[model samples]
Target chain A: MIMLLNECKIEMIRIFRNPYFVFWSLLMPIIFYFIFTKVVDTGVDDQELWNKHFLMSIAVFSVMGSAIMTLGIRVVQERSEGWTTWIKVTPLPSSSYFIAKMVGQSAVHVFSIIVIFIAGIILNGVSMTFVEWVSSAAWILIASFPFLALGVLVGTMKRVDTASGISNIIYLALAITGGLWMPMEILPKTIQLIGSWLPAYHYGNGAWGIIRGQFPEFKSIAILTVYLLLFMVLSIYIRRKQEAV
Target chain B: METIVEINNLTKEFKGKRAVEDVSFSIKPGEVVAILGPNGAGKSTAILMMLGLLHPTSGTVSLFNQKPQEQKVRERIGVMLQQVSIMDALKVKELLALFRSYYPTPLSMEEMIRLTGMQGSELNRRTDKLSGGQKRRVSFALAMAGNPDLVFFDEPTVGMDSTARKQFWEKVRQHANAGKTVLFSTHYLQEADDVATRILLFNEGKLVADGSPASIKQRLLKKAVSFKMDGHFPKEQFLAMEHISDVSEEKGRIVIQTEDTDRVLSSLFSIEMPISDIAIDKGRLEDAFEQLTVEQGVS
Candidate 1:
C-alpha cells in the first residue's frame, strides 16, 4: 500500500512539473470557458439557463481533455522511451502502476474542473446553490472515468507522435459531436444521433442534469458505464498484446 | 559456492525464427559473468527470458531456485536493459526514490549516489536534461538501488566515456566483493577479458564457448605471426609448414596461424623468405571469439 502511494506521488510530481500538462489541463479550460461564455453569446432567452448549460459543457470538456489527452499521451511517450519496460521488471505490481496513473490524472481533472467552474462564476456571472455546485462537480468528475480508459487504450496501442494527434482528434470530436460546444437541438439530425450514442454526450448530460435540479436519465448513465467497461477491457487487451510482442 | 542462477535448454523463437536456441548455463554466488556476443547473437533475448520479460519457447530458468517471475525472485534481482530510457520529467532524486520503493530492502540514497559517482546538482536535474553519459549513470544507479543479490546489466557502459567506464567497473567489482552475483552482456572483448570471472560466448543463439577468458584463449592455442613478405612465395607452401594451422593475407602481409610460433619461424628462415616487420602475439580473447564464432558459422 505504501509503495502504491509512493508511485502515485511520483506520478503526481511528474504531471505537475510538465508545462504541457499544466497548460492543457488547467489553463486551457479556463481560456475556453471565457471565450465561449463571455465573448460568444449563445443568443438564448434565458440567460441564467444558458450560463449554466455552457458551464456544464466546458467542465465536462475540461475533465475529458485532461483525463484522455494529457494522461494518454504521457503513457505513450513513456512506453516509447522504455520506461514502462523498466517498471515491468521491478517489484512494483502492474495494478499499482495503473492506479498511480489514474490518481495523477485525477488530480489534473480536479484542477481543470475548479478552473472552469471559477471562470463560470466570476466571468459569466453564473450562479448555483452550494449543493448544486458540489453535485455538478461530482458528476463531471465521475464522467471522466471513461475518458481515462480511452486514454489508456490509445497510449498502449499508438506511438508517441501519432498518439497525440489521435487523442486530440478524439477529444475534439467527442466535445463537438456530443453537443458540449452547441446544444443538440441546434446540431444536424445525423450528428445528434451519433452524439446521443457517445459516452461524452451522456457525461455532459449527467452534469447538466444536476445543475437543472433533475436526476440524469438512467439510460445515459448506463451507456457511459458500458463505454467505460469496454474501453477498460480494450486497453488491457492491447497492453497485454504489446507486452507479449 | 551456491548457485545463484540456472538455465536449462532454453530456447526462444520469434515468428518461427530462433532468437535463442538450446542454451544453458549456471552462475555461482560472487561470480561476475559476462555474456559476450555480436549483434543478433541472442544475448539480449536470453537475458530477457532469464528475467521473465520474455517467455522462452522451451526450457526453464531458475533464479534463487524460484521461477524468475515470482515476486520473491523479482525482489532480489536488479536489471538495466540496453534500451532503457528513464522518465524525462522526473528529477534524478525522485526517480531513485521511486525505484527504491519497489524493493523490500534498498541501498541508502547516499550509498547509491556515491556508488554511481553522482554529486551535488546532478541528482536534482530532470532526467531529460541530462547528457547521454549522465543518464547512463543514473540508470546504473537505479539498477543497484535494490541492493540485489543478482544484477543483470545489458551493455551497461555503451555510452560511457573511458573514465566513467572504469569507475563503473570498480563499482561492479565492489558488488562482487560483497558476495553478490553480477551478470552483464557486452560485445567489447576487452570488457569481458578485464572484468568477468567467467565468460559466456554466444553465436547464432547458441552458447558457443563458456569458460574463464584465459581458459578459452588457451584452448584455441593459436598464435598469430605476421610479416611483410616482399615476394609471393606460394601460399600453399606456408600452409604445408609444420605447426601452422592456417594462412591468410591482410594489407599485403602474410599472417600465419600457428600453434608453435618457433617452428613456423625456423621454417620461414630455412626458406629464406624476405620477411620484415616481424611480430608475434599470444592468443587473445578476440582471436578466440572470432575463431569460435567463425567456426560455428561454418558448420
Candidate 2:
C-alpha cells in the first residue's frame, strides 16, 4: 500500500510538470468561469441560477480533465513504451498498481474541482450557501468513478494512435453533452435525453442539482454507478487479453 | 545445484507458423547460459515466454518449479528485454526509484548506480538525453536493482562498443560470482564463448546443442588445418583420404577439414609435399554454430 501511494505521488508530480494538463485543469477553468459569469453576464433576475450552472459546469470540466483525458493519455503512452510490462514483472502487486491509478485520479479530480470553485468565487463573483457549496463539491468528486473506469477501458482497448483520436472524440462529446461547454437547458431536447445517459451528464447535473439545494436524482447516480462497474469489467477483460497476446 | 528454470515441450505459434516449437532446456543456479541463433531463430520469442510476457501455446515453463506468471515466482527473476526504453522524461535516478518501488527488497539507488559504473552526473540526466550505450548501461542497472536471483539479459550488449561489451561481460561474470542464474541471448559468438558456462543453440525454434563451449566445439567432426604446401601437392590424394571430410586451396595455402589429422598427414607425407608454417585450427563455436544452423536450416 505504501509503495502504491508512492507510485501515485510520482504520477501526480509528472502530471503537474506537464504544461498542457496544467492549462486545462487549472488555467482554463479560471478563464472559462471568468468569461461566463463576469464578462458575459446577461443581466438576469436570478443571478444565483447563473452562478450554480457555471460552477457545476466547471466541476464537470474538472472530471473530464483529470479522469478522462489525463488518465487515458498516460495509460496509452505507458503501454506503448513497455512500462506496463515492466510493472508486471515487478514484485508490486498488479491490483496495487491499478488501484493507485484510481486513487491518484480521484485526488486530482477533487483538487481541480476545488480550485475551479474557489476561482469562481474570487474572480467570477459566484457565491453560494455553505450547504450548497459542500453538496455540490461532494457530488462532483463522488461522480468521478464512472469516468475513470471508462478512461481505463478505452485506454486499454487501443494503441497510442487510436487512443489519442478516440479520446479527443469522447472528451469533446462528453464536454458538450454534459453541459460543460454550454447550458444544458438550452440544448436540443434529443441531446438532453442523450445527455442523461452519459456519466458526464449525470455528474454535471448532480452537481448542478446539489448547488440549487435540490436532492440529486437517484436514477442518474444509479445509472452512473452501473456504467462504472461495466467499464471496470471491460477494462479487466481487455487488459488480460492484451497480456495473453 | 538446483535448476532455476525448466521448460518442457514448450511450443508457441503465430498465426499458423511456429515461432518456437517443442523446445526444452534447463539452467542451473550460478550458471550462465547463452541462446545463440540467427535472426528469426525465435530467441527473443523464447525469452519472452520465459519471462511470462507471452503465454506458450502448449507445454510447461516453470521458473524455480513455479509458473513464470505467478507473482511470487516472477519476483525472483529480473529481465532486460531486447527493447530498452525507460520513461524518457524521468531522470535516471527517478526512474530507478520508481522501479525500486516495485520490488519488496532492492539494492539501494547509490549501489545500483555504482554497479552499472554510472557517474554521478549520469544519474541526474533524463533517459532520452543519454547516448545509446548509456541507455543500455542504465537498463543494466535497472535489471540489477532488485538484486534478483535470476536475470534474463536479451541481447544485453547489442549496439555497444567493444569496451562497453567487455564491461558488460564482466558484470555478467559478477552476477555469476554472486551465484545468480543468467540467461543471455546474443548474436555475438565470442560473447557466448567467453561468458557462458553452457551455450544453448537455437535453430528454427529448437534446441540444437547445449553444452560447455569446449564440449560443443569438440562435438563437430570437421577441423580446419591450414599450412603452405609446396611442389605438386596431391590435393586429390589428400581429398581422397577417408578421414578427410573436405579440402580447399586459398592462395598458396591448403586448408583441410578432417576428423583424423594423423591419417591425413600420412597421406600428405607420402606424396612428398613440403609443408611450412603449419598450424592446426581447433574448430570454434562460430564454426559449430554455422554448421549446426546451416544443417538445420533455421526457418
lDDT of each candidate versus the true structure: 0.84, 0.79
- Prediction RMSDs, each to the true structure: 6.3, 6.1
The TM-scores of all predictions, comma-separated, are 0.87, 0.85
Stretches off by above 4 angstroms in model 1 are B219-221, B224-299
Write the residue-wise lDDT of candidate 2 on A91-202 in tens digits. Answer: 7777887787777778777678788888877765677888888778887887887888888877784577787778778888988887787877779999988987887888
Docking level for model 2: medium
For all the models shown, what interface RMSD does each have?
1.0, 1.7
- The runs of at least 3 residues in candidate 2 whose Cα sits more than 4 Å from the true structure, single-residue gaps closed, are A42-44, B127-131, B217-255, B258-299
C-alpha positional error of residue B207 in candidate 2 after TM-score superposition, expressed in Å: 0.6
| Single-chain TM-score of chain A, each candidate | 0.94, 0.92
- Per-residue lDDT tens digits for candidate 2, residues B149-209, read 9999898876777787778888879878998889988765556777888888787888778
Best by TM-score: 1
User: Which candidate achieves the best lDDT against the true structure?
Assistant: 1
